[model samples]
Target: MATVAATKPAETPDEQTLREDLAAAYRLVAHFGWDELIFTHLSVRIPGPDHQFLINPLGLLFEEITASSLVKIDLQGRPVGDNTQPVNPAGFVIHSAVHAAREDAQCVMHLHTVAGTAVAAQRDGLLPLSQNALLGWDDLAYHDYEGLAVETGEKERLVADLGTHNLMILRNHGLLTVGATVADAFVRLFILQRACEMQVAAQAGGADLIHQSDAMGHKVAAQGRAAFAAGAGLSWAALRRKLDRLDPGYRA
Candidate 1:
């Protein structure tokens, strides 16, 4: 039998909270066109001795994801407890690698937005051309792409490539980010994608780009940390309120 399928689901309170937050992330990503049909994944680790986590079901649209609709899975991406939903091999391959290695990465988000992919395919990769890029200054990594990310062997190489970085630009692929919280991951992805969009747009104009010195970048990042932290949590709540106004079904 294959390993990445289900056992059952316990659906405890803490796990349930993780489910809602992850589902909220899926909904936000879909609302912003950051979702690629059901290809990419956003997962949050469940609190326990075991390294289990919550991920969206493989076939569901991001907008269709609900708290109870999420699948609980192990590090291998197999369903835990009584879940029947199938897990995405790609999600397991990438997310489990980081979760196993980084205690800081409680939430992992992988996205395939147009801007992120466009910038990633560039040889230089995420030029420090915009203030948005400063959000991840001195805190980014790059991993050379290795096809569709299916083999278990690729997991080790990918995690090694990721190292201690919270944000990674997968060469010729897309953007990846991990955070201690769902809000943090979402904000990092938001800033990275915005940076990519600005870079691609600026380059399209064929204008001479001006980049800040690394020292200036570091200084600006440090200055922005407090506001960035507050804004991420604040904007997340605002967006959740917007979601509730539009369609609160994700909170199910």
Candidate 2:
């Protein structure tokens, strides 16, 4: 059997480490072509009672995000500490709602990928047309798009739409996923994105799509539960290694 990398350290990570992880997620999103220029955002909540989180600074592309450059901000979306980097208001509005509402949502990733938005536009939303789709089938939620997500009032509706689910498709907007860790959230987004891509490709052929029955959905869910029991640490480790080879600047 091949050896795998460790998922995380034994001790709780400090703010700096969290910054690096979130930065890696940004770079990975860019690397995978999921980034929409300087739009869309990924954030991780700081472990404290102040309801703080780290997000990409405005006006920078995803590839430009670095650990040291991540801006820490308060719940009201004000930059914390001496960091003067301005954050995207839309990013804060969406991310803050999740961080404040759900304790398990330590990390939240939202993207405006072509396939993701395409699926969101479809009446059926994400279909169980592929294996990756099954991974999120059980935990999926849907939120109707409310303009650009800049209003504070949208936070209440966004949280209400997200509810208890970790995976969400912001209708006619894009994809969103939350997790207990950065790795978990990234992996969930990966699955959701790939599923959307596959669905779009399959639909283009104009062929009748194969839909998995409810029984198969349950079976895949069980198998996924067993297979990913160790969580997304190993996958994250491999991706980090790949990033190290490609561009390790995010760690800076």
Candidate 3:
């Protein structure tokens, strides 16, 4: 497990900040071309004991999502309020599994991109073909695709497969990442998706690829973890500035 920076309970972010941050994640993911139309989901748990969360409303493109447009739901995926916005039950099935088991996973992101899903289809998961892949080498887990993840029973198996890893590649499906904050999760997902993209490109080259040794990979993994933990927030701040300049509506 990577060393997560200590965040005291008193410093828990308010719901408004969490809402804007999570909304920004959706915008950024869409900006980077990682969104699968209006299909995939990103969620952030509100600070409380209710197991409540904020997620993009169904039928909205990631780019169209605004903080005020986010839907609030309970653990069972039911809307906490009037339930005007559509919520995807499949998203609930996938996200609730992680939230149930991992208390630290305040924000969860899952996506289906070409490189990410292409790598998931392979027999071997992410290969150590690039430094980006090795950064998350030790923290990655694999879960076999079990058809549509709408069945509630699959949650148990999903959580079991995830175990302690923060990154998971759903075989023949897509990618999933968890984080203590939306910024951390977004950064982790960015590196993970890049790693998969690099692996796919290397494999397509039809040439021998360099695979780093486990001993060296572990050392690199440690450094990667520290760097991400230390700098992800800074990157988020910078990116959020860009987002603000581009369109500040996401903060609504």
Top lDDT model: 2
Candidate 2 residue 214 Cα shift, in angstroms, is 2.5
Poorest 10 consecutive residues by lDDT, candidate 2 = 1-10
- 238, model 1: CA deviation in Å? 1.3
Give one digit per residue, the lDDT tens place, for model 1 in 1-252. Answer: 112333244357777667778888899899999989878999999887899888877887888888777787888777776666887888888989889889999999998899999999999898879898887887789999899977889988988888888899999999999998898899889899999999999999998989888897787678767587789899888988888898788776
**What's the best-to-worst order under lDDT?**
2, 3, 1
lDDT digits (tens) for residues 158-240 of candidate 3? 99998989899999999999999998889989999999999999988999888988887788899887778679989899999
Error of 2 at 110 (Å): 0.3
lDDT of 3 at 5: 23
Residue pairs with colliding backbones in model 1 are: 7-81, 8-81, 8-82, 8-83, 9-81, 9-82
Q: Model 3: runs farther than 4 Å from truth?
A: 1-13
Taken over the whole model, the C-alpha lDDT of each candidate is 0.85, 0.87, 0.86
Q: lDDT tens string, model 2, 219-240?
A: 8877886766376889999999
Q: Model 2 reaches what TM-score against the true structure?
A: 0.93
Pull out the clashing pairs in model 2: none
